[model samples]
Target: MPVFNQYYYEPLETKDVLRLVALDPATDERDPLSCTIFQCRRSAQRQEYSAISNTWDEQTPSQTLEIRCDDDISYVRITANVDALLRDFRAREKPCYLWVDAICLDQTNGEEKSQQIPLMGRIYGEAKDVRIWLGPDDRVTAKVFTLLRLLSQVLDVQPQWHMAERVVFHLNEVFCRKDGVVGLKSLLNFFSRSWFSRRWVVQEAMLAREAIVHCGRYSIALLSISLAATRFLSLDVASYPVNMAASLREPTTKRGILELLWYFHEAECRDPKDRIAALLGLVPNEKRFPLDYTAHWTELYRQVASLAFGLNDRAINFQLLRVSAPCPIQEMPSIRRGSLTGQSLGNGPYLSFLTYETQTPTSGILPHLNGGNIRFSPLTEASHGSIGIPQSAGNGVTESPT
Candidate 1:
C-alpha cells in the first residue's frame, strides 16, 4: 500500500497576499477532487475569481481532497460541505479560480486565520462573482428555485407595484394555483436552511460585486432570491440574516455596526466573538472594533457596549440597551442598567434607577408621561433597572409625571 502525501499551506507573505484554489476539471464523476493553491495580491486589477459563501457542516466527518502544491501532490481533509461544493465545481469543463475559506486559508494557524478573516469582506467584494453554496439540492430545491424565479419575474415586470398590491398578486396568481401550495411550503423550507442563518454570509452577500446562489447543479441570481423574499416574507416574520442583505445594500436602510450587531444577534457562528467580527467590514473603519479573535468574548461584548454608549445618540443608545439581554458572563458591565438618561459617562461607573407608578384604571391602554423633571446622579455601585413609558391614550392627552 502507498501512503498519500499530506498537504501543508505555505505561510502568507503579506496582508495583501492571499491564497486562491484553482480547481482541476474532472471528466468523470468518480474522479477525486483536485486543486492547486497559488498566491494572489488582492489589489491587483483584472484578477477574475469567485468567492464562496457557505456554512461549515461540522456535524459531518471530514473528507480528504487532492491538493497539488508546487511540485508534489498532497491530500488535505475538508469539511463535507466544502467537498460537495468542490465536486459540483469539478464537474465543469474548464478550470476555475475560487476563494473558498476552508481550503484557501490555513485553518490551523490562528495568526493567519485572524489576518484573513478581516480581509474576507474585501475578498468577496473584489471577486468578480460570489457563489453562495446552500449545500446540495434536496427534494424541495427545484420547486423553491422555480418559485423564486417566478416571483422575481413578477417583481421585474411590476417594479413599482405597492407592497399591498404585490401581496394581492401573490395571493391571487401565485398562491391560488394547485402546485403553488407545495411551492410555498418548499420556499419556506428553503429559507429555513442553515445557510440563511449563518453570520458570515451576511457580510459575504452584502459585499459581493455579483452573487449567484448555487444548490447542486441549480443556480440563480441572489437578487432574484432577495426580491422574492421581500415580496413573500412578512416584515415582522423575516429574520434579519435572511432579509437584511438587500436592505443593507439600499442607502436609506444602511445601518451602523451597532445596529447590525443588534439585528444579527441571533445569526450563528462557531465562535461567539465572531458575532462582532463578522459584521465589522460593513461599517466604516472608525466604527469598527479591533479584529482580535484572541480577546475574551466578554471583552468583545464590553467593547461593543462601550462603542454604543460613546455614540451618545439617545435613540440608538436606548434601542441598544433595551434590546440587550443580561450577558451570560457576569463580570461584564450591564450598559442597559448603567445609563438612565443615556449620557456618556467617560469611563465612570454606571448607575441605574427604577421608576414606579400607581395603577390607574380607564381603558387598558397605559398612560404616557408628558413632562417631568427627573434628577440623576452617579452612584457608587452598579445595578440594573428599567423605565416604563406607557403608550399615550386617545384624545392626545398625556398623564402628568408623578
Candidate 2:
C-alpha cells in the first residue's frame, strides 16, 4: 500500500480495488437506512454491480452534512438526495452492489479524487446497469413517468402506424390538452431536474450500456427519456426544449471536446475543476485532455484551447471561434471559454456550423464564381524560392514545383 499526496491508496493487487455499498432500507419509514461499504477485489471474476448517477444536493444548506449510517464509528458525509436515492433502490429480497460516487471515492483526499475521475468511464460502462437518481417524485414526476411510458409505446409501434407522423400527432395530443399544460410543465420540471444537468451523470449515462431513471418509487428506462426529449424538440419553446434535447442526445459518434463542454457546461457539480474532469472521460482517446486537479480553471481552459489548435484542422479549430459566451477569467479569451448561463443552449456550436457541406476554398473564392479556376503564385523573389506560377479564370491552371 502507498499514499500519493494526502490520499492513501493501495495497489490493485493488494487492496480491494472495487468499493461498493449494500443498502437495505429499514422496514419502518421512521428508521434510518442501513448502509455498509463492501470492499472487493476487481478481478476477472466479479459480481454484478450497478453505478448510481446523480446530482449533489448543493442548494439545500442542511442537506450537506455528515450522517450516521449502519456502519460503525466514522459518520459518512452525504447529501439528502443521495440518502433518498439509496432508500429508493434498496433491495428487499437480496443484497445489491452499488458504486456511488459520494461514498465510494475519498472526497477529502484530492489525489484519490483525481485517480477516481479517470476510472469513472470504466465504472459506468462496465456496470451491469447505471441507475440515474432524479431525486424524489411528486405529482409532476408521476406524470413524467406516465408520459415516458406512453411515448415509448408510440415510438415502438410508430413504423407500422405511419412515417412517425402518427407518433407526432399523438405527442401533440398528449401535451396540448387542457390538463396537458400542467402535464407539460411537469414534464419540463422532470427534464430540468439537477440529475439531467449533472456533469458526472452526463458521462456516466452516456457510457452506460443500459440505464434507468429512478424517481422516488417510480423508475423508467433511459431510452424512454431520450425518445421523449426528441418528441419535445418538435415543440417551439423558449429554452427548455433545446436544453433538454442537447442534454439527452447520446454521444454515440465521436465529437470534439468543445461540443461536450458547451452541451453540458450548465450542469451542476461541486468542484469547478470537475467542469473538465467529469466530461474528460467521454472524449475520444486522441482528443482527450489531461485530468489535473492542481491546475487553475483558466489554465485548464487554455490547455484545452491550445490542444484544439495543435490539431491544425480548420474544421475543428474553427469551433474555438464559434464560442458565443463571455469569458469568466480576464486572463482567458471569450473564444476559449463558454458561458455557464445556458445562453446558447441550442444544437451546439459545432453541430450548427458543420450541418452542411461547403465548397472547398481554392483562392478563397466561392458559389458566385459560377465555374472558374484559381492559382497561387510562388514565393516572392525576396524569399529565394524558384517556382512557376500560372493564372487562369475559366479553366484550370498548372504550377511547377520548386
Candidate 3:
C-alpha cells in the first residue's frame, strides 16, 4: 500500500550481504564482490513505468519531473526517478565507493528490506565511497554536488587524497518530518548514540588511536559513567571479564577503552550543531573542547550476545524512531508518544553490522587484550587476601548470555 520511510543510499544487511567488499583486489576483478544498488535505466529516463499495466509501458519525456517525498509519489514534480539516478552513477564511473539504495538493497525482496534498515551504518560504513542520487532537478543535483564539495573542503585533503577511507557521502535530507530544526537534532541524536555507542566503546577508541593518534575528550560524563553502569549490572564475568574488572578500576588499557570514548562523544557532540560539525569535520567551536574530527565514522561496536542469535525480520522500521518536533532545529529528536510505526534494529547489532559492512579481514590485526596486566588469571591465588568469587560461578558472575 504505502511507501515506507527509507534512507536514500543505505547499506546492505549482514545476511543479505550477497557480496564481500574490499578495495581494488589483487586479481583482475572488474567489479568488487559486494552488493549493489541498481535500477531500470530506461524507466528512469522516461519518468514513468506503467504500474497498472505491469509492463514496460513508458511515457513521453517531459521537461519537468515529479519526485515523491515518501513512496506516495502523488503528483510531486521536478526531478528524475531511480533509473536515471543509476544511469548517472554508471556514467560518472565515480572513483570512490558508491552506494545507491535501489541497487544496494533488494526492493523486490521485501523480506530482506526490513532487516537492512537498522544496519544503515554498516552499509555506508563498509563503503569506501558513497554517491547520492538527487531526483530530476538540476538544482537539486547541483546543490548535492556543492554539498559534497563543501563537505570535502571541510575534510580538506590534497587532490591525491582518498575520501574512500572516510566519508558517508550524504546526498539529501528531504525525507525528514521537517528538514530544518527537527531534522538537524534527529540526525544529531541518531549519530551520537551510534558513532560511539557504549558496547563497542573500547574497540572504537582503539580504532581511533590506531588510525589517527589520540582522538578526543568529553563534556558531559560518557565513558566513566558507562563503566560504572556496566560494572554494577554485569552478570557474567566469564563473558565480560575485561569489562567487569575495568568497571571497578580507573580506565587505563584498551580493554575498557570504551569508557573513554563515551567521554569523547559527550564532549564533541554535546551541542546538536557541534555534534554534526564534529562528524562533518566542521571545527568544534564549543567553549569546553576543541578537537577537529580526524577520522570518519569508525564502526567498531560488537555485541557478542547478538551473535548468539538470529536476526529478527522486524528491524526495518527505524522510521518509528523519528519524531516530528515543532518543525524546528535547536532541539533534538524527542520520542513522540504513539508517533512512529515500530521498533528498530531489534536491540542487537554484532551480527547485523557485520551483515552489511562485512569485509573479510586481510590485516590480521592482533587482539589487544594482555593477559597478566589486563587479562584474567586464575582467581584462586589473586583472590587470597581480599574479596573473591567462590570458585563455582558464585562471585556474581554467570555463563555468558552470548
Candidate 4:
C-alpha cells in the first residue's frame, strides 16, 4: 500500500486504487468491528467486493463505541448510521470484503479526500455488488414492501401501468378500500425516506453493476424496488392515488446525472458543491466536464451550462425561461440557471404550448414562425428592407441581403 503524503498520492501504475476493509472473523459481536485497509488495481485484476452506500449521520461521530482487540479495549467514534450498517454486516454468517467510504477514506486528510473523491464512480462501478443502506426496517417499510409486491403483480400485466386499465380497475377494487388507506399512507412515507432524497446515493446507485437494498433484517433487490415504484406511480388514478408527479418524488427508474441533479435539488449535502461533484460520473456526457475538485462552485455550474448549450445552442432562447420562475441566484445568468428548468431546448415554443386549452391564438402569427425560431438578419442604418424592416420593401437598395 502507498503511504499518504502531501496534496496528492503518487499515481498508481494501474486504474485500480481502492481501499477495502478486512473484517475480523473472531468473536464478541458487541465489540466494534475490526477493519484493515487493502489496495489493489481493479481494471488489471478482477476482485470480488461489495461497496456500502449510506449517509453519515451527525450524532454518530460524538457517540463513541468500544472495540476490544487483543484484550485491549479502545473507544472509537463513528456515525450512528455507519455503526449500525457495520454491525449488521458483521453479523452475517460468512465474512466478506467490503468498501465503505466513511471508514475506508481518511476523512481527516483533505489531500487524500481530493484524490479519492473523483474515483467514486469507478469504486462503486467495479464492485461486484452495491449494498444500499436505508437505515432500518419499521412499520412503514413493511407496508411499503407489501404495496410494492401488489403493484408488481399489477404491472406484470403491463409495464406501463397507466395504459393497463384492467390493472387500474383491479387496484381500485382490491386495494383502495377503507382498510387499504393505511397501505396508501405507508407508500407515501416509504418514498419520503432520506435515502431516496440523497445526492451521493444517486451516483452510487447508478454506477453499480448489481445492487441490493438492506433495511433492518429485510432485504430486496434494488431493481425490485425501482420497478415497483415505477409501476405504482404510473397508475394515474384520479382519487386516493399516489401523486407520482410530485417534484421531489424519486423516479422509480434510472435517470441521467443532469436529471438527478435537477430532480433531487432538495437533497442534503455538507458541501453545496457536492451537489455537482457527486453526479459527475453518472452524467451521460461525463467526458465533457472532467472532475476537478479544485474548481470553484460558480465555475462548475458554468461548465455544466456551457456543455449543455454547446450540444444545442438553441437552448439559449428565452422561451425556455418564460415558463420558469426567475432563478434564485441573482448573480447567475438566467440563461445558465434555467438549464434544468424543464424547458424545451429546441427552436420552438414548448410542446406544452398546444396543450394549453385556454390560451388564445394571436392573429398574424405565422404557422410555424414563433419568436423562438424566427432568425433576423443584421440590418445596417442604410438598409431599407433587410430583415428588421417589414415585408414592404420601400427601397431598391437591397444588397442581396448579405
Candidate 5:
C-alpha cells in the first residue's frame, strides 16, 4: 500500500487572509472524498462561498479524508459528523465552496486558531449563506420539514400572531389534530439534535445573512424552522426549541454579553472557556474580552465578571452574580464568602459593594435596591402590572432576596 502524504497548511500571509475549501465532485458514492484548500481575503463583500456550522462529534470514529493543498495529495483525520457532511456535498452535481473551520483553519497551530477565532462572526456573516448540518436524517426528518413549511406559511400571512391570544388558540387547535400532533412530535425530535444545543451555533445562526439547515438530503431554510418554533411558543408549548431558534431571528448587536450568557447557559461547548468565547460574536463590544484560547478558564471567568461589574449597571451586576455563582469554576468564591475576593477575583470596588449588598438584604432595603419583584394576579384580572413593595413587615406576597 502506498502511503499518502500528510497535508500541511502554508502560513496565512496576512491577518485578513483565510482558507476556503473547494470540494471536488465525486462521480460515484464510493469514491474517496477530496478537496483543495486556497487562501482568500475574508470580507462580507466577497460572497463566493458558504460557511458550515456543525457539531463536532468526538464520540464517533474519525475517518481519513484526502486533501489537495497544492501539487501533493495529503490526508487529514475528520470526525464522522464532518465526514458525513463532506460526503453529502460530494454527492452534489457541482462542487461546493465552503469555509469549514476544521478544514480551513490549522487546528494544530494555536496562533492560527486564535487569529481565526475572532474572525468567526465575520466569516459566517460574510458567507452567501450558512449551511447548518444536522447530521443524517432520521425517520421523522420529512415530517419535521413538512410541518415547518406549513407553520412558515401561517407566519407569512400574519407575522405578529404570536402576541394574539385568539390566533394562538386557533394554532393550538389546528396542531392538536392527529396528523399535526405527530408532526409536532417530529419537530420536537428534530430540535433535540445536538446541533441545536451546541454553544457555537448560537452565534453562527444569528450572524448569518441567510441560513439553510440540512439533515442528510433534506434541506430547509432556517427561517422556516425559526418561524415554526415561534408558532410553537405562541401555543404555550415548552420553549426549549423556540429558545434555540427564536433568538436567531433577532439582531445580534442588540444583546449584551451578560444577557447572552444567561440565555445560553445550558448550551454546551467542548472547551470550558468557550462558554464565554462562543458568545463574543453576538455581543456588541466583542473587543471588551478578546479571544485567547491559551488563557485559563478561571482567568476568563474573572475577566467576564470584571466586565459585567465594570458596566456599573446594578441589574446586570446582580444578574452576573446569579449566573456566575453556580458556575463549575471552583476557584472563584460565591457571595457566601462575604466577598468574591481572591487572586482570581481581582481588586475591584464592585466586589466589595456586592459583598455589602449580599449581607445587608434584611436591613430594610427598598425593592429597587434588589432586582425587583414578580407580581402574581388572577387570570381574570384586566390590568397586570408590576408594583414596588418595600422590604417591611406585612408586605403582601413579596419576593425573597436572592
Candidate 6:
C-alpha cells in the first residue's frame, strides 16, 4: 500500500467529510458522556468489520440491545434494580423518550451507523421528548428530551400506538421520522427556546418547517449524505395513484402539507450526503453550493403511495402551481438559475409544485400532465459557467412566493 490521500476534496454535501468516529471513552477515563441509563443485550444478527478499523482497533464489535425507558422510575433508590431505575425516573414525573444509540441501532461499527445516519433528522424530528445524560462533565445530549416536552401537544386523533409503533420511526424519535410519515403534535410553538440556548436556534427554525425540519442554518453536509444514501429510487410499497377525488375534496391547502414540504425541501437542498458530514457542516451560499438532492427527492416522490399521505393528499389540483411532470434524478439536475440572471435566479410559486410527495417542497400539490420521466443530474454543480434552465417551459418549476 499506498498512503491515504489528504488532498481536500469538496463534497457536494456534508457526510462526505470524514468526522471523528469517537467511541464511548474507556470507563477509567473522564468520559463526559458516561453514566446515562442504558440497557444492552447480545445481538442476534452480526455485521462485518474490516482492516481499516481493525488496524486501529477504532471501534467495538457490533452489538444490539433492547434499550428502553420505563414509565415508572420515581420509586428507585441508589443501587436500584432495573425496575428501580424505572421507578426513579418516573418519580420525577417527567415524560421522556429514551435516546439510546445501542437500543435504536447496532453499535458494532461505522457502516451500520452510516446506514442509520439518514434517519437522524427524522429521529430528532419526530420525538416529542428528547434528553442527554451529560455524563460527569455536563456534556450536552442535544437536549432532545427537553425539546420534546416543550413542543405544544396537539390532541389530534389518538394515534393507534400499536399500529403507529410498528412504524414509530424509532430512529428519528419522531413517530415516522423514518418517513412512514412522522408528525409533530399540533399546537407546538417553540418560540422561547432562543432565550436558553444556541443549539435550539437552528433546531427551532428547522423545526418551523415541521414537514422537513433541518435546513438552511443546520449542517448542510449531513443533509447531503442522507439524501444521497437514501434508497428512494428502489422504494417498495403499495401503489397509490394520485386521488383526484381527494384533491377536490378540500382543495389542497398548506394545512396538512407544510411539514411534508419542509421535510422535502431540507432533504433536497442538502449538498453533501450524511449526518456525520452535517456535524462537519458546510457553507450555505446557495450559488456556491447548490444542493444536489435529486436522487433522494425523486425517491421521496416515488414512495408517495407507501408514505403517510395517500388518497388524502394526492388529489389536490396543481393547475395554479404549474408543477412539472414527475421525474427522477436519473433524468437531470434541476437548475432554474437562468444563465443571464446568474446568482440572482429566483424561482417563484409554481416552482414549489411537485408531482410527487417528496420531490419538491412546493406549498401546492398538482398532477403531472407531461410525460413520466426522471430528472437526472440536477442542479448538482455549484458553479454555473454556461448551463441554463430548460428552454422548454413544460418541465421547469418555480418557488412558492415568487
- In terms of TM-score, the best-performing candidate is 5
lDDT of 2: 0.57
Model 1 stretches with alpha carbons more than 4 Å out = 1-4, 91-93, 155-180, 234-254, 310-316, 319-402
lDDT of 5 at 59: 53
Predicted candidate 4 versus true structure: per-residue lDDT over 64-154, tens digit per residue:
4343334544444567787778777774455657888876676665556666777887798888899988788995575466555566555
lDDT string for model 5 (1-402, tens) is 135476778999888998988888887767888888888876434438889999886655368778875577888778888888888766456778988888888888877877878788888888899999999997767756776776766634444454444334433454565334554565667788888878899889989999999999899999988877766666566445567886678775766665666566567788766777788877776435676777655455556655655665454455334424332222233322111112112343233222222212332333324553322111111111101112222223222222
lDDT of 2 by residue, 1-402 (tens): 112212232323333366777665455554455555655666567767999988775744232222233443234545778777777777766666889887777666666665567778888888999998877778556656777677656544333436245444554565665434565566666777776666677778788889988888898888787776665554544254335444555654476666666566556667656766788878888777666666555455446555664665354444423432232222222121124434321334442212111223233333214232222233222211111122222223222222
TM per candidate comes to: 0.72, 0.69, 0.22, 0.64, 0.73, 0.27
lDDT of each: 0.63, 0.57, 0.26, 0.53, 0.65, 0.25
> Among these predicted structures, which one has the highest lDDT?
5
Each model's number of backbone clashes? 0, 0, 25, 2, 0, 73
Model 5 lDDT-worst window of ten: 379-388
Residue 39 of model 2: what lDDT?
57
Q: Model 6: per-residue lDDT, tens digit, 361-399? A: 222233232333323222223422211223232435431
Query: lDDT of model 2 at residue 19?
Result: 70
Writing each residue's lDDT as its tens digit, candidate 3 over 1-402 gives: 123323243343344343221111213223322222223222123212111000111323222212233343322111234334323333223232233333344445444544443333333333332232212332233333333233333342334224322222222333223224432333233223322322222222321211111111111122332332232222121123233223423333332112232223323222222222222211111211222222221211222112111222222123112221222222322111110012112332211222121112223221111111111112222222111122222233331211
lDDT score for residue 66 of model 5:
82
RMSD of 4: 12.0
lDDT of 6: 0.25
TM-score: the better of candidates 2 and 3: 2
The better-scoring model by TM-score among 1 and 3 is 1
Against the true structure, candidate 3 has what lDDT?
0.26
Residue 269, model 1: Cα distance from true site in angstroms: 1.3
What residue runs in model 6 are displaced by over 4 Å at the alpha carbon?
Answer: 1-33, 36-110, 113-129, 132-259, 263-377, 383-402
Tens digit per residue, CA lDDT, model 1, 244-267: 544534541346665665556557
In candidate 1, the residue pairs with backbone N, CA or C atoms under 3 Å apart (3 or more residues apart, or in different chains) clash, namely none
